[model samples]
Target: MVNSITGLISNIQRYSLHDGPGIRTTVFMMGCPLRCAWCSNPEALSIEKQLMIFDQKCTLCGECLIVEPEAISLDGGLRVDRALIKDIESLAHCCPYDVFEIIGNEMTVDELVDECMKDEPFYRNSGGGVTFCGGDPIVQADFLVEVTKSLKNRGIHVTLDTSGGLPWDQWDKLASAVDLILYDLKLHDEKRHIEYTQAGNSLIFENLDHLAKLGKEIIVRMILVPGVSDDPKDIELRCKRLRQSKANVSLIELLPYHTLGKGKYTRLGMPYPLGRNNEKDKVNVEEIIQIIESIGFKVYYRSP
Candidate 1:
């Protein structure tokens, strides 16, 4: 008997510094348990191949339209007939300017390892390695476990950027393999959590609690949505929870909400429920850092 597993990968970002400790390759996996209104990676929201159109880049070359089993039409831009779509690769490749893009690809453990290893010199030189970010990588625990094992064997550091919404029992081994956990904390209030994230915070809290109890290295990444989760009291409560959880909260990173991925929704022909928070001046990173550090935690801003 043999065990073989392949996971759907959304993208493999190379030479990324913000993802972890040093220069690293960040593997973006598909599928997520929660749909946060402010999610930046709209392409990673679904666990399937999604067509993205950039009309500005389209020269009306008609290359994509000429392909047999024609999946695209030019109605002011490259419009894909979802019902007629067959080979995603075929349609995507037909584009010369790459206006038509495919979001996800399938990769086996060995294949992904090969890709990650290509940047071994960079990782070694910078004390950086590989990070598995998602739509929650925990969804593909088995595949991640195997890939993590391989990376660890090569002395490469591994970081799992997760929402911490899945059952701990399912990926406890994977957690043990990780050098750091980039845990996301959206909202502390349960009702508000569901209202924004389309899910409750119970499981996320439980998983974080258990991981903290295990004394795993964790860095909490909180999204600062203006008027939504920017309350000082709520932030303080969250910090207190982390302090009580006993998790080695090395850093608390406040990520200010951006409308970067909002355009992606338009490209995908989907509704962008998370509109821009125009009151950007309201976000005070220094003050938030003070509140978090008051609870004895270090703080950083994803963007100030």
Candidate 2:
């Protein structure tokens, strides 16, 4: 997709089980400025350099060698070693099969459309389509606009998974191109939001308001984080705010926390804040669904 899409990406998960409606190909983008404490995608936090290792597939052959001090045996589809991968990055520059490779790659809009078009037939049949996911689509707004436009031009359904934290000026270019936006609302309180994500969310709310007014197809998403986002009062407040936003968004998706990305941070030499076994309640999902339904909105159970 580099020749067509103008940005870096790590992987294109084809026929993804969950991400959006149908069997979607979730394009995992790179680089996000936000440092949300509860984020599972540690790999998407930075664009500079990253290291990843699959502990399950490691052979422990002990033939590892890499550029960074922390990196070991991540150069290629090689024999594995029991070495720490933290503090190593130069190792990724020499890989052949993406062993211990970075998650994002650079591509152009034309190039992305060209490459993604390879799966057109599958999308047509499975009610599946392409989903632009990342730290946030707004991080790469320009590329997303062109790519989504191209997809629309060719009669493909386009979905944008974003945090709605971008400036209104940049968003105007993408409004018409995106068919649906899986708008992620992190925290409603300015100070608490800043404290948790290290970034204020006033702009996020403003953008949501604008998008709702525009009457675009929207699905509101909330990460059902345990301590960070699961207070009953907080959920009610969020609900109240949404009731007042008057945005056109009608669907709600509840994404509960999982330990899927903690190992990513370990390979990158970063501490896993949630750590393994930091469990969150699955029971709250019913309550959340009830509340959203009570508000007279349709809700998708998972991240459809």
Candidate 3:
């Protein structure tokens, strides 16, 4: 019998080629420890259920106003006091125009496994399987372990995409369960990392060193944000650290920053952290690739 372990899920993206090997069904679990300034999926940041207003779809029917007058107002346009809303879930149903949407959904272990199993044929044909990602999957480690175990029992290949911000014990068990680990290396300096992500790199680095020594397959993902993380020296420091740790790294994937998820902040009634001013900020791909390759690591980059 499958246990009734439930986890908060943000989205289950199907047919994704960028996450891991082959075509994958990336299960994005809710909640994260790091707040990357250039995060694309802002909805996945919070552990709690958040309301997203689609102002374009809203007919201004005034139905949602009846549910929470203080929270919902139509003074000039659709104005939502997100913090003031207590019954956030109720607003999702109250909107006849389907304007309001709740970001997170609860899924039991069995249900999630069943959902992933739907794409088993694709997984087998394309050498792909389910990948557990998140705001950072480590936030829901316990619940995901059961889900991963259930999937593995069904003969599915599993991958974990994480920032490695949590402690060792949390990653140890899950690392043993998954086949591939997509580890993120955001910033080399601990103070800058704290300033940007609101967390230190000490625990993350320690966990990476430990994971590497365990001989686990790891693909270090580095997101290049022009002003934030695009420094050559910092990148070199990260590569040197990985080399020093003797990490079992298959390759290093360079992810470029984009304004794709900026609109999500507006929907969630939150300010876009990096703002639109940096939209034109570009990264020197050739320079970054040269640096990583010179360090004796294979590189993977998809042109945007």
lDDT of 2 by residue, 1-304 (tens): 2334477776777887566677777887776757777777888777654567654555544434534434444355443342654433444544433455655667778778877888888888988789988776677778888888788888888788887776777766776577778888766677878877878887887787788777887788888777677665666677677878887776777777677777677776578765445464444677777777787777766631
Better of 2 and 3 by TM-score: 3
Per-residue error (Å), model 1, residue 209: 1.6
Error of 1 at 245 (Å): 1.5
Clashes of 2: 24
Candidate 3 Cα outliers beyond 4 Å, as residue runs: none
lDDT at 303, model 2: 36
TM-score of each: 0.90, 0.82, 0.97
lDDT (10s digit) by residue, model 1, range 238-259 = 8888888888889998887877
Which candidate number has the best lDDT? 3
Instruction: Please report, in order, the local distance difference test score of every candidate based on alpha carbons.
Output: 0.86, 0.71, 0.89
What is the C-alpha lDDT profile of model 3 across 1-304, one tens digit per residue?
A: 8678899999999999988899899999999999988888889998988788899997778998899899888987888887788798888899888898998999999999999999999999999999999899989999888989989998899999999999989768888888999999999999899988889999998998889878999999998888889898899999999999898999999987778888999898888887545656778888889999999999988666
Query: Comparing candidate 1 with candidate 3, which one achieves the higher lDDT?
Result: 3
TM-score of 1: 0.90
Q: Which prediction has the highest TM-score against the true structure? A: 3
**Which 10-residue window in model 1 sums to the lowest lDDT?**
272-281
Off by over 4 Å in 2: 1-5, 53-90, 93-99, 275-277, 280-283
